[model samples]
Target: MTTWTYAELAPDFRYWLREGLPVGLPGVVAVSLDGGGHYARRFEDAPPALTVEATDFLLPLQPPVLYGDAQGLAVRLTDTGRAFDDCEVVFQAESPGFMLWTIHTGPLADANHVVRVPALPDGRAIRMISGVEVTCIENRDFADPTRPERTAVGASRR
Candidate 1:
């Protein structure tokens, strides 16, 4: 019974997804679009959370996607190969030309991950795959206002 602002435009829209590994692991978290160069960061200790931008060019190529853990903290999409699944619209809000859409992929993940998506893509849409739940925020606003453009390698966002 949840409502989506953009659902009317694309009723079947679903957010992309990612897997959340246990904290403290050491590895590289990479994100990339079909043609765009990949962005990656290697960490000695896995971070508690991460955020990435769903560029306008790539978004138009596919439906939106999300994956959340417990604690209501949006996560990143670690794996983009998995197909989209049904989800529940937990929250939605209108914001001028854009909107905010939050969904629950299922029970809070074992890692207490969360993913926030503000917005989609097409026939073989330019997909974006990452190594972790993607949290899509409005392009006009910061992913986390308090930590604008701040990324703490191998640190926690708590």
Candidate 2:
């Protein structure tokens, strides 16, 4: 399974996320696709692909919170543009309610994000006020097999 430490996103990422810039955080997001299905092992396997890459952004948040059972991050877009097209994650289950924890990003949403995170409280969804327009969610199964924790946000390591 995957084990990691909780670190904040880089300063630039945090800024975009907070300000709602859609250009996306500038950086290379790499994950393993193969090798043995173990810790940091996906860097090897291909084809049936052990790694997945995406144009990732740092969603905004006030401050992060880690519940006794789980941890979560929330963000809203600064740019008032088209809604998100689609978001895909590695923990494949068709919809939001499987073994994978869920993050919800949508339109005209206020930090009044109780609908998506019905399991949690309304104030629980992370939020930021900025220039662009977007919504972002990041959920964690604190004890899952695939959360990327090795990457550092800025030049500094926490």
Candidate 3:
């Protein structure tokens, strides 16, 4: 049984969504929620290993749903839209916050392909994609086992 929290697995999940799934990675898949209150599996190469439906939620507005099955686990966010298939997502996580780096490789490659989303505890998780930055309110603090005092937030070249 694995005991990794959403904070710990978030970066890996984002990477898988941004990039393609590696050969043998067997963990939870992450899905972003759209404004319509529906959960979508964005990655074409690797879809959600588990079955996740919006009816699973107790309420229509509730978000950040987690589902696990024989295949693995999945976390679906209710406020974000589908991740762009042509962008490469890189993320860094720490206590209290996490950052997502998206690199666009499509026709917009000539434009600013790099965008960052900085998440703060009890603050806003910014979503920057396609030249638009949307802010979503976060309810809880991100907790990382490695660092208890402060969570690191930044983007680095991969």
**Best-fitting candidate, measured by lDDT?**
1
Query: In model 1, which runs have C-alpha deviations exceeding 4 angstroms?
Result: 1-18, 54-158
Sorted on lDDT, best first, the list reads 1, 3, 2
lDDT of 1: 0.32
Q: List TM-score per model, in order.
A: 0.21, 0.19, 0.21
Instruction: Please give the distance, in angstroms, between residue 79's alpha carbon in candidate 1 and its true position after superposition.
Output: 31
Each model's lDDT comes to 0.32, 0.26, 0.30
lDDT of 2 by residue, 63-153 (tens): 2221222344332222233222222111122122333433434332233222222334443433322222222322222122244322111
Clash number for model 3?
1
Where does model 2 exceed 4 Å of error?
1-59, 64-98, 116-158
On a 0 to 100 scale, what is the lDDT of residue 105 in model 1?
A: 53
Count of clashes in candidate 1: 30
Native RMSD of candidate 2 (Å): 17.9
Clashing pairs in 3: 18-89
Compose the digit string of candidate 1's lDDT tens values, residues 46-89. Answer: 56765656541223112223444342324343323332222233
List clash counts for every candidate, in order: 30, 17, 1
lDDT of 3: 0.30
